[model samples]
Target: MIDPILPFSSYSEEINSMLPETIQKELVFLIDSDFMDWKKIESILKKFPSISHSIVRRRLDVDFGRLSRRLTGKSIGVALSGGGAKGFAHLGLLKCFEENEIPVDMISGTSAGAIMGGLFAMGLDSSDILPLIRNFWLDRNLLGDFTFPFVSLVRGKRYSQAIHEFFKDRSIETLPIPFYAIACNLTKAERKVFDRGLLWKAVRSSTSIPGIFPPFAERGELFVDGGLLDNLPGSILKERGAGILISVDLGGGGQIDKDEMYHNLLGPHYLGEAPSFFNLLFHHLKRKL
Candidate 1:
């Protein structure tokens, strides 16, 4: 009944005529950005055109809004941080929330935090995801940008594909709760939000740890990890109107050892000689390696 890859061109004429001016403009953006193909948009439009159409259903639906208000009536936001495998610590944190009967209204994440946040937004229990991560081997999952780099052992699209398998036919907007990834544009030294397009693409961008995983492109913009700009994204959740914020720390602080920074004495791809300022700073930052 629903297909994510359905092409929009199939019913283009029918939809273009019916959609309002504002929605048409939005759809144009989605189509142009490769976020939603024409067909998938058509499928959604055909089923759920507007809130006006769902009014009858809304009337018949149980007014859980009243029940929700009766029970504390507050929104809680969860913020997750990036730390590669260190992010697994969030499972224990999320479990604590579950045991405490705290509810999550929205989620914001960066880097590996994006993976955990995305799955949770898709309605997967933290317990359900634990086994998946435990069985996952980082080296076997993704192959990086080029074959020559040891990073080539990181297979990005494969990870994206596996995520699609678990979160089939769901994009960012379709998730049960509002979820977003913070990604940094290395070229601009700016922080950006991944709210549109493929959830995996955004997750990939958020998790793209510069030299570790290659940059991801979305709508013609390149994005690396959000940690580059806002490593701790507590402020991001606050901006999103979180009534209360719960932060799960999966990060560490330690002294950087310069000797371990060099890989085979090649200076981590000879980045010291690179022209970009980011590359230069990257070399220094990798001192902690």
Candidate 2:
């Protein structure tokens, strides 16, 4: 499974408990992000000595050849990607896996993690799109590059506006940013404030980007919608009948407004904050399998 191991989320124990003993014997690589304390992960690995580890980070500079060798004889490769630079890096790894003929079952936590697990992976800049869409005009080596006229028209608009226009009839709304800050501050007093809906109002008022906006706002929304329903990219993982499981952190206000896209990245604060969603996904997998 392509499990983006966030700094806070740990699924190793759950995975170990769920898999049958016989199937566990064949599991090969337990690839995770270096952000995870190696000591903690190593301790967990000790329980299942048969599973090997591959820690990925920016400094390591992993390539497809290295990955191919790692998975040559393996039945399953549990890959992880999370955090800032790590999100883009994780997409690079996923691209590598697609190239190497490895079947992937992906799990993502926050926005960065979730988007990479999506069908049309989102990127930080145009440069990130090159690897996925090699034949697009953007990828063709252009002489005297001229900025697209559309870029100038949408410069000052909010992310939700850009996405709404792209989707035509689809409606989208931006998530309130104040809600995120309140969620981050985990205190009984803070919780009470949010419960009163003050946090949502604050986020709606305070968060504003002058010239910047989210890339692939519509694509991200589509993924969150379709990925949850297992509609888009239905052909990619056809053998499973259903696609991958998605669990969004409710602490991040998992309040997806229809036809609206939040400007900032969405995610959970710390781990275990969205246990209900996790439990729901677990039960769904149990029934599907």
Give all candidates' CA lDDT scores.
0.58, 0.29
lDDT tens digits by residue: candidate 2, 71-189 = 45322322222232234554566566557854442222233333343322111223454444343223343222333434222332343432223223310111100011111111111
TM-score of structure candidate 2: 0.24
lDDT, candidate 2, at 90: 49
Best by TM-score: 1
Q: Would you estimate the TM-scores of all the predictions?
A: 0.63, 0.24
Candidate 2 has an lDDT of 0.29
**Could you tell me how far off, in angstroms, the CA of residue 73 lies in candidate 1 after the best superposition?**
8.1
Candidate 1 residues 63-143, lDDT tens each? 233224223435577888776667787777777877886667778888777888888876567788888666654534454
